[model samples]
Target: MAYKKEHVKERFRPKPGKLLDQVREVMHYHHYAIRTEKTYIKWILDYIRFNGTRHPREMGKPEIERFLSHLAVNRKLAPSTQNQALHAIIFLYKYVLDMPLNDYIDATRSKKQKRLPRVLSQSEISEFFKHISGTKELMAKLLYGSGLRLMECIRLRVKDVDFENHQIIARDGKGGKDRATVLPKPIREDLRLHLKGVRKLFEQDLAEGRADVYMPHALAKKYSGAGKSWLWQWVFPAKNYSKDPRTKKIRRHHAHETGLQKAVANAAKKAGINKRVGPHVLRHSFATHMLEAGKDIRRVQELLGHADVRTTMIYTNVMITNFETLGSPLDNLDND
Candidate 1:
């Protein structure tokens, strides 16, 4: 059955689209990505329901602020969590609700500063890797070896790996920026083996009369045959094709990050390491280890694709945990 929107298929159901159409229309006008639109709508609905099903239209900015504050202050969400909620509400006001969020909310009530990222020791990393295998092992290698974010590792395409140049080209990183990272010396062989398997899969798909692959966004429309091209195939494709809503086409996406997350957890337990290990931990370990090796901070900043030097500066602290080495201003008290 073809469903027109993201709602129940039953004919007698009250249908959700009518309730959220105005909100969706405004977000569409602002050119927000469909994933973001869905997220913001879901958050908005949660906000409304949490406020005793009071219509969001009836609530003021103070109420919205309180809800976000509750997430941070009471629920003790991380800074990223607070920011995600904030971005959703901000989008709802400026785009969906067609109002100014700044008009009612004070500047003093936003998310807190981000602390330095948690990193693992080289030995710890090796032990962690010993416990994982197959897809999870490859995913972790991308995170640590290429300095990729969790999503970036999963979203990689076959063409993104420039073996000739020994670099991994990351497309659609944070802030929609694309950059390249060094391909680790160790994984060159592994990637080559992985590519051969992918080639066999691609050939089989072609033999089975699969006309094309899924290209990113409107690229498929512009070049109808581009999907079948080797460049368009994901480096880590899902086992099956998903039905794309907008075009109603079946396409293979990359593996879900949650699978890698679960893998990391099991590996962490097997290794008997207590610190919470996630894919981002590998990225942090990459940055911190580079800094600890006496690499130039500016270069580390570039390699990590950090926009601000201040963001990169945080990693230096991650490497040098002993604050006593800084020779604190309190030393003047001893002289006095």
Candidate 2:
């Protein structure tokens, strides 16, 4: 029953023609977000197609520079969009192809836009919420109340909320950071009632043998069966199960972000607010209103998870000018 040594060697050798599969494996190993995995793959495929599908291993810096230039000059992409393409290619070479990029790529950079965020006033905020109801309304409330990004509100897990402390622990927020934020007292009872419904859905999922959600950073392995646990369930679960892109297993996910976006947009339109408003506008309103209410900018920085106070200071530009804070020159003259 002896086996051929060549056949044995063949079994251990890596299979050919699976570069993208290899990239996916590497990304999974690094615990990249599912959305990021999809986005990176898209950019990589676009790069390949733009260059007539030449294998990435055959291309180097000149080709990389040329493609990035095309994105800026030809496609007229934003700087962030071009940078995403660059990062995808860099990841492919560095991690998947085992080749590192040079210190400088020397490509034409894309256009940078420094537009300020759109914000809603307090009355407009009231009007905006009046037009929407149910889960989306709750999501919008949390976005404005907790100073949460749209996706941050979407991805909240059950265990991350602290009802007693009146705070929410936003897990894995933008830039891979986490922060604690205040949960509005007004929404507490509604949120608790909402969770009761969600818990019932979780129980139903368990009874029907479909109660599992995605976990980050190989946590699903270390804490096997934790995915189906009540604490790990999404605070706002999707209405349906879908195939996970990485594992190919059917798992329920957080509510799709687009649905919330559409709901908020329609709600804004129906509310007859003139200015362009979206989920992010609510976040902007949160920061502005907090500052207006005399909350310290540094404290707002921590709650909003801003890396620097400079970033938080953008909200100050939208604050109403308080001339009273600087007594009028006429008043000063009268005093003198």
TM-score of each: 0.81, 0.89
Candidate 1: tens digits of C-alpha lDDT, residues 1-336: 011122212222222465477666655444445677788778788777778888766887678767877776677776665666667766555554555454544422435666668888888898999999986798889899878998888888888899999999888777768988889989999988988887787777777766377566567678988888887787887777677644567666667778998998889889988898888899999999888988898888877889998898888777856567867788768764
Best-fitting candidate, scored by lDDT: 2
Checking candidate 1 for backbone clashes, the offending pairs are: none
Clashes of each: 0, 0
Residues 1-336, model 2: lDDT tens digits:
111111111112223568788777777766778788889999999888888999998988888889999999999999888888888888787767767675578899887888887988889899898999999999999999999999999999999999999999999997789899998999999999999999999999999888988888879889999999999999999999999877898978889999999999999999998887788999999999999999999999999999999999999899878678967777757554
Model 1, runs deviating above 4 Å: 1-35, 100-104, 107-116, 209-211, 245-248, 320-336
How well does candidate 1 match the true structure in TM-score terms?
A: 0.81
What is the Cα-based lDDT of residue 295 in candidate 2?
Answer: 99
The candidate 2 region of ten consecutive residues with least summed lDDT is 1-10
